[model samples]
Target: MSIRALVYGDVDLNTVDGSAVWAQSMTRCLAAAGCEVTLLLKTRVGNERLTAPLDGAPGVTLRRPYEESLLDDLGPRGLTPEQAVALITRLDSERRFDLVVLRGRRTAAVAAHTDALAGRLWTCVTDVPQTATGLTSAVVSELTDIAVASRLLLCPTEELRGFLESSVPAACGKSVLFPPVVVPPPEGAVGPGTPRTPLRIVYTGGFAPRWNTLEMTGLPAALGRRGVPAELHVIGDGIHRDPAEWAKRMGRALEDTPDLVRHGGRPHEEALRLAAQCDVGLSWRAPEADTDLELAAKVPEFGALGLPVVLNRTPMHEELLGPDYPLYAGEDLDSVADALVLATDPQTYRSAAQRCADASGRFTLERAVERLRGHLRLALPPAPGGVAPERPLKVVIAGHDLTFFTGLAEHLMALPGLEVRLDEWEALHTHDQYRSRELAAWADVVVCEWCGPNALFYARHKRAGQRLLVRLHRFELHTEWPRKLDIEKVDAIVCTSPYYADLTRERAGWPADRVAVLPNWVDVDQLDRPKLPGAQHTLGMIGIAPSRKRIDRGLDVLAELRRRDPRYTLAVKTKQPWDYWWVWNRPEEREYYERAYRRIQRSELLADGVVFDPYGPDVAVWLRRVGFVLSTSDDESFHLAPAECAASGGIPAVLAWPGADTIYSRRWIHEDTGAMADAIHSIVTEGRFDAVRAAARDEIAAKYSLRRVRGLWTDLIISGGFPEPVRPDGTVPAIR
Candidate 1:
């Protein structure tokens, strides 16, 4: 059954304001996750861009019953909390929604009367409005009731969560993280090239007093005195303050530089693009004004563009980016200028860019959807009678590499309401299966990890009413496995990313609907740990024996980095290439490895800087000694090594291999060995190794956690109905 949900917001869906954007994003995430969602707004919106998500979305609906203006609604003329509760109650009866999400203070007020919808109600407090007359008893009572009535309170930042929980005791245990959701930068959207002169700097967002708006005008001139030629580009105008005064002040302060550009204000997208072209981001909020803000949304916006930010140091900044971030500014203009000068040094800028770009991935629509699903899963009530099942879902997992699928099976087994069965097939030479026929006959669902003989065996032997699932990781596509596996008997084909799914459809001519993209599981919680200090100078690579892995490119990157700093070294946690049985037997494979091995030995830098370690038992312990992990693969369905390293707080430098951009933000993706070398230097010299490591860990923890991917597997195999296979004429059958 599809989940049904309703979202309430006090803004028009047509407007491009914070409330509208948040509502649209929340609803869009719900819809994408197979939820039948209805968005209820206080006023009708007319902007086409704001309403675009609802236009073609399946299982999504929008409504605006109030004709009243926004200004009047905030005054005495608006509907009261009781009135909102009654109206929403009536809508719930009509729509039969499974959950109701109330956004903002007004909606939170109405939550008190939503007892009939008890476990179904969730409230989000975007910000606490300061009344002109200050807080009163009536307002306090309403705020407290909001915490008491809602099943969960969603806070966008840790500071906000701390504030809300402290203010109302009832909110302490229930608050969940729901930070701002950023639209990912377009694929292949890169920053302006290196070797740019007169370092370009950009400042975006409103010139609100709290942002310390007027202080930025002197930055370019201050940097100029320090022998650094710089240009300041102001991309936005004053808001919540006098615009005329702002323009007058900026003109006076920047009068010395004829090249200064004050763009006034452009559309958000246009401004973002302009900012992306600049070299650095400036954001300095006054110390006095930094009272309640947990995070600044503009930070992620600039980070998405690969621009390092120069912002005032605060508890929030320290928490988000570690305390050791080098670009943190002080209250004075000189402090801000000094930070900017240090940040624009070609190498310094490169490291900051990688960290900022990598950190931005945690604030995307995909992460938002993952968080939404987790909250919804918990908010859902137990089934009536709470009775245990007679028999659990008997699952048979057949795979050559139990090393890869063992974690997934264990996670599935841990979930309540499901009893799992596992089956490990032998390598071709051994040809042994422990009661494999009995296992297949006894199982309700059978999963094969790779498109090898096990998948073919299940495809040929799967009984009627039994489900067969095959996951085709990288390497499986190029082999003959796709042709051998019979598609007629397979219930589903899982690819790690959409890129590989398309490749399978093109190469194997399999039905598109039969394939689903689900990333491999990474135990992120286990990888989060404190790293050794020496790890900063070490670069690590997992598999280098295969030609497709492009180990030559990795060596080139190592040689380039060693040119800049001799402290840098490359660590290879892999088996010797000659040990592989296929190497000498295959002339092409032997030639590639032998040539690359000779080059490594002949080069002074590689011979002295590179160290090889054979395969080990604990990857987590192995990652502790490595600060930066490199992925120079020519192709991959989904490379799990970099993710493991990142989860272990190691910075990952992935080459722009075929579909790598889909999995990693473009900042960490290097186009060549020169760029990779510059980035590695930038990270270590600027002392941002710890910050980047923390960011990588946070990203992995959010996207690929064991619990999160386990839930997806559960839904795909048991709960959610499977999409019917697509036909050659571009037609699809209804989902089962």
Candidate 2:
């Protein structure tokens, strides 16, 4: 029997934006999987202009809110809490839904009102608790109450499951790890031929700050310097400025190098087509943004297109690219140039591209949709409101912050049904305690954060009834953390990106089924901005550490810029004297700190104009003043600094490091210090800084908005089997 499901979110199904594309792909996947899927979108004012069909997928229907005030109703202007409850009641009375899947906080609340039909309700939660607002809070509370009172719950990643398990007691027994549905490649897509004319390098995304378009343009210019035939095609709308103006500015910068091509923005199909024409795909992420989950969708798209990728050596990339992939680049231009040279060779890159294509098949939308369908089948039987015998649910949390533990404790305290506690314990001078065995005994579940070094050891000691879950960040592979973690004993591991999850599972000796990928969350309301001009010239960096953060690397770029023009003043937020020692061991700390301190002291001596803000007190003010933000991390999980800088309307100058490339495209970096200096000069002297900042902010607000992430989290969590209800009926849920 086929299941009928209702999916609701704020994505524009007609557009080519990431969220819209995801929604469209999901709709297609669900339809292809033989599920009757109706998508309910919050009607926006200009939505009529975007009335494209939902890709003509079978078993799919698209609907808008009845009153046209759904967005307002979700916020302060529309429905009051009591009115919302009444409206939800009225709506459910009209339609008999066998299953209702909530996408975000607002939609989740609507699902919650159907508690009487709790046997049929499923809530999908995406990000951490930090992203939602009072409205989201209300919806989450309702969903939590329903999960506690209902039959089934789904979590996308173990990270989210841990969060839900701690936030709502009803989630303890029902939760399961279900990653997002992977979209399939279009049919008949073939790999590109050898670099025939110009070595066409394509970057298919918006010209956002995170895209680091200026830095990207500089690479082609750098190639021009080396006398290599290279051209860059940027195929997306201007996230910050008018497409024409952005093209004009970028075009002028590359006028001396005839090989460079700035194709500006194109429609989704057109962009993909353009990308197909290229020999290489350049994708990257901001190392500091902590939002690398966005890249999960793009990586498959690149592979499906059959383009060899010049990726940043992030853990996600390392996981996704496999061993046969091309070389990993650091922050230096020579490193990127070396990678570029290798990638330009058809013999070297073609096989790797094929490998990427092969890998992409594993994550195709059809497979993901089928996986989700099976999970739903297992989840649907018990129904929402049914009650069954209760048993002690064993859970294990591997690694995380103290606040996370406290949060979990608070959530468990609210629910009296299941007992929960931490499973392992270690004391670190940095955070007070590293791990605790006492906490492990108390925990029915074990939760762990895959910080570094200790993940494998903790994974090895799992006992029966205790499921081991390792939450991964970007730094897992770059450091020795993966080496130390025991993968065989881990019941499940969660990642923010599928690329990362797949990689972690591959390396850790864990079953493929044991890994789950979920997106991270951010506070949307706090990301609000006051209208300001984008021409600010001040540059900012918000991280404190040196080694992987590559603080010295950023200073080098700045120093190069200053050598050309003494007026180039850069601002940095450095590590506190005490925190500097925490990143490395005593011996490594001494070596790294001495080098970093000397570099900082030397930069200060060389450029008295450079300013250092150790305490980040003026971050807000500096954010407004800065035209650019720099990220030079040698390694990273997801850097929050660059994202925050872009959100504050600053253009980003990112080091083309490994983990960061997975988040942003490589087109954002210069191949060398000279190129970096030149790009900086162009931005400052050519008045392009305004456009960069404008594009940066728009991209963050629209594409990486906390709201979009929240929706993704909801989908992943619900699809993963968290908050599933127990029923008297003899129905078993599918685990794969």
Candidate 3:
């Protein structure tokens, strides 16, 4: 099936605005990329007013939420959440959508929070997320939430993307750049050095306070003192101010010089056509209130028409153009005069115009759209056979957090005869019913990552031809979910360890044949590393929090080991325990952590022997400094950290949890904290540490290595544990 993108625009397409043009051009280009696009708009622009850029585009459909007159005077407002959700549901019922392009801040919020659009939502934030106080306020939290909830968070500039990524690390992988999209000028557009009288200077766009349009009125008088005649061509009007008041102000300024020509708001093409005859473009802004994140589309619009732009200097400008670019100006009229003078110079104008035209290439319709298309290809890879096959198995992995399944999802993407999609619920209970029902209609196999509400959702929605599989780790079985999940609707239940498998099956009264033991896949090759020389005396643990992790136990083992050997040290790579949301909210949990903190402060572990490392990306590099990995958790399903430690040539000293033996050997599993410390000391003193580490690495490589058993997942997805279909004669079936 051809991929479909629902382009949600908040404004009337017939209106001449930057956002409106962006929405129009993107939809047209997406259509050109062979994506069937349905433009769901909230404006009054009717089918007849859909201009040349959109009307003739192939595979394009337009839909509006209200009558043409409902939002005429509202000025670029988006559909309400209810209207957007209703529209999404109506379109989704016709056919499942592969992607949803949410345009503005309000639209992104509406789409990102809507459950049906969860994993498929691509949000484009068109404005900066800052108030007068900057990003340090509560708006930061709102922006962070939007970034975290989106499958891909997009902005129009690299500067904005960098700022957002620095502010919110979770946006690192999902955020993308959607640069300004400019429509190239018509055939035989004027080049640099085109003759124009009185050095005609152009200014296009509204007379907003931040725009500083009044500054342009003085350009003509300033250049007059330098013995150069200049005229200003103002091609647009203000939105927030009365047109008569704005016109009167400009008329008064012109009465003194008569060089300012105020051409009120016109069609986009007509304005650009008028701007083409001008010698230069002027764009100035008030420095204090300006949002430097947005590169004025009017600047590039002039660049495309071969006019050198005279604009203020900002970080975004310095990034797009060289620092030494001649046309940059400050707020003072003298700076504006100097920039215009340089633009009017014969030799200087030629070079500046050429540079401006070249820079405009970055914003061309083909160039900007290609970048968006590349991100789309990464987000929605083509199905096998170069298209969706007739009987292709649609495998949907439904989960709350699938961070551990990232590797498996990559493997499944490459697996032949499968169309896989990950549906990650932002919050299980808050998931949208329409989205769940849509997944039910789309998938042949639904693999629920946790045996909580997701599993219950699939069980309740299980259809005739669809197979349901739920993977339970350790925590869910302790909850009421085990009893809540309907075992009859589920075809299979996967457990990460055999211990949990037996316990869960007995508790849920599931048949033995319906349960399977599948270990979590860890990339062994990526984890294997040479241990550092000083690492021999160091003990390490990962994820030491939530009380169940038994960080206190790890500290006790560290103190005991240090008493025996002064060289021994403990390194913990974990998120700050007190940073968890529950820490400040729950009184009992706060008390527990406060006491733990007091103990650490009083003990020598915090003084010199223990190093608390914050969580980082390169686990393999961190694992190199760990000679022995400690799993001091009170309970766990499989605990991949110890396996990771073994892969990095670190001996595992696991505190015996309920399923400890299923994951680690009995020799490594200890009954108590003191015994675990003794085992590590014995391994080191007897010179058996190296041998144990090597054997552990070998076992992990053989059993849980991603490459070794990816075929098992492929088989499970392709075959669904069903017997081969045979003819009634009891003979082998023919291959179709």
Candidate 4:
């Protein structure tokens, strides 16, 4: 089957810009994958003349919708939404495309309207809204709607995924395909004969508000003060202002730094060549901003050219480069200055550069395009490997959380021809039930959730004949378990989020591909119902303990709300206190647990409007009365409270857990709570209870529904060829 793709965006392949670099590399990769790619460049005024074909990218075909005269008249202001849409519609009418990939706001708007295009349609969103600007909000809303409505939405980073999922109703079940950065060999692969006069540090790429250009200029001065002989080279023109003017201002700010050489803006290859010779590359971005979510492509480009990078600590980089990458946190000048001092040391810089390069392999064009092809299969089937015939399969689920195990078992039981066994083990502090050889011999596939005892058990029991899958929930590694567990014993380690998978790979030293991501599934059909009475004023929180769950935050929100409105009541369902005591290794620590539990219990008892309930089977039914569910967690793998609450027709106001954000985002949370007080106020004042409830149900029904999740599990099991007991309907019998 010939794969034909049409990419629409403001891409100028001739220029050495970030978008251009991406377009060129992606087009090349698609071509290499035997896909015929046509790039439709949305030319702005004066930028039309900049349209030129990339040198090595022969497989890419470029076309401009508007003439050079019209584009030139528009200048840097660019095309309006209506104009861009009209142009894309015209192009769509002329050519039938198999896949239409849109970029940016205007182009996405255009592609959204092009229903005439055949095959699946996808949009690549590169921005997020942090401020309350009208245009930003409008674009965000449009993109959100597009994401919710479109066939696929591709995001470059987990941070962006979080932002999109929280803000956009459309991203609920979306597949996030991280963007790749192509690294071409440096111009001078071999070093010069003699030592260079001075160590050169380069900063290339367009100047944007998020680039924090002023900080880049100050870097040279900082390095000089640290007694390092370095020259600063500024490359790439700015989109907003002249690159030359910005360079001049930077040079002046550095007191006319003697070795500084400002080359304004050069071609991509030339800039890369210069960067390769430099000892270090500098880039900075604010984590809270939208632009930061779209990692600056330059970081990888610098790495590809063998230059050590000094960048701001953004979630995007953290996802791609891992936590150990050399990064300076915060936006303070001193932090940047300190990084500059460390970056100038050739040995240190070179080692860091090598690490960056090694990491870059994961995001290579070849890898990204291959992954994209696999994900896009959801929309378009492969010519040869269409969905295989369903068959009976044996699956085993191992976990401590009875609720999770029950939920999964119920979902699996609903599926036809699939036999799933629940492997329950007593707590490590209790009887050593996990050591039972019968349990190991009884199952074909063993699924272990959480690290500790389960990981150790897997190491002891798993052999060449057995299939072992271990799941790392939030902060499981933060404990000493990952360090102590023999990870090599497991066949596969599953994580709920790619971010966590990457984290595990780094911290646990696991193979990249071994860490598979299988997000938490929900039973959506169960949630289709009207809200229960008192749902408008009743808020619910599910979970016990405070250290990791951050239940205190939820209590704080409830306390503040109750002070303002007596009508507002909070209900909490905590696990039986004795159950925790039984599971805890140190029974003496029961005092510590009891003391903390009593405080929460006492708070609820003292508060006239608060109610605390013990965990029970009817918890789901009770959750229906909760107008909102609170997730005040410090850590989670994939918190089921918000998802369950949503299923139960409850609104969810969630804060970013320390590690949860790596898997689920604020978007998955029914309502995002950046601040506790603000969140409580909104839930009380804004009558968005219905909207939140509806949105939550819609998300669960589409992505996490048992029907949908059953198919995913069936596909995996059938593909892997697991044995199971056959039923009357030729389906797998449910193992009780």
lDDT of each: 0.72, 0.55, 0.74, 0.61
Per-residue lDDT tens digits for candidate 2, residues 1-736, read 5667665544444334555555555566667767788776544323332234462456876654444554334642334434444544455577655566554555455546555655565665653353224226555566566675444455543345544654555565455544544444345555565554567777765555455555676676677677777887766543545556766675455455455676654445556767788877776544443324324455567778887777667644665677547756655555666677787777887776887787677567767777666655444422222111264343444444543234333333223233445433344212213345545555545557655534554555456665555567765656666666666665556666445665676666567776765434322223323323332445567764645565566667777766667656677766654574556556765676577667756764344756776553334434545666777766555565666677766666767654455544344455655676677678778877768666666655554445444333223222333212111131222222
Ranking by lDDT: 3, 1, 4, 2
Q: Where does model 2 exceed 4 Å of error? A: 44-56, 65-91, 105-124, 129-184, 211-214, 238-270, 290-295, 331-337, 382-736
- Separate clash counts for every candidate: 1, 98, 0, 9
Top lDDT hit: 3
Each candidate: RMSD to true structure?
17.5, 20.3, 12.4, 19.3
Could you give candidate 1's per-residue lDDT for residues 435-536 as a string of tens digits? 777887888889888889888877777899999989888778888889877898888899876677888899999998788777777777546545755898
| Model 4, span 272-378: residue lDDT tens | 66666666677766444524456677777766766667787754566567777764545866687677676555555666777777766766777876766655444
lDDT score at residue 109, model 1, on the 0-100 scale: 72
What are the models' TM-scores?
0.48, 0.44, 0.57, 0.52
lDDT of 3 by residue, 1-736 (tens): 6878888766556555677667777787778677899887775554333355565567988765555443333344556755765677678868888888877666666566767777777778766564435766565676666676676877777556656665665565566777777876766666446535588888886665567776668888898998789888887544545456775665566455468888766666677788888899887888763456778888778888988888888767766666777899887889988888777667778777887887888888898768767767666654433234566678899888887777678667644467788778888675777888898889989988888898888888889988898888777877899798888888778887778778988888888878876677766755665576678789998987687887888888888988888889989898876778865577876777778768877886545788888786457667878998899887888898888888778887888788788767676788999898888889888888789888888877766777644545555666654322222121332222
Q: What pairs collide in candidate 3?
A: none
Best model per TM-score? 3
The residue ranges of model 3 lying beyond 4 angstroms of the native Cα positions read: 12-14, 45-52, 64-96, 131-145, 168-170, 194-196, 242-257, 289-291, 385-401, 407-736
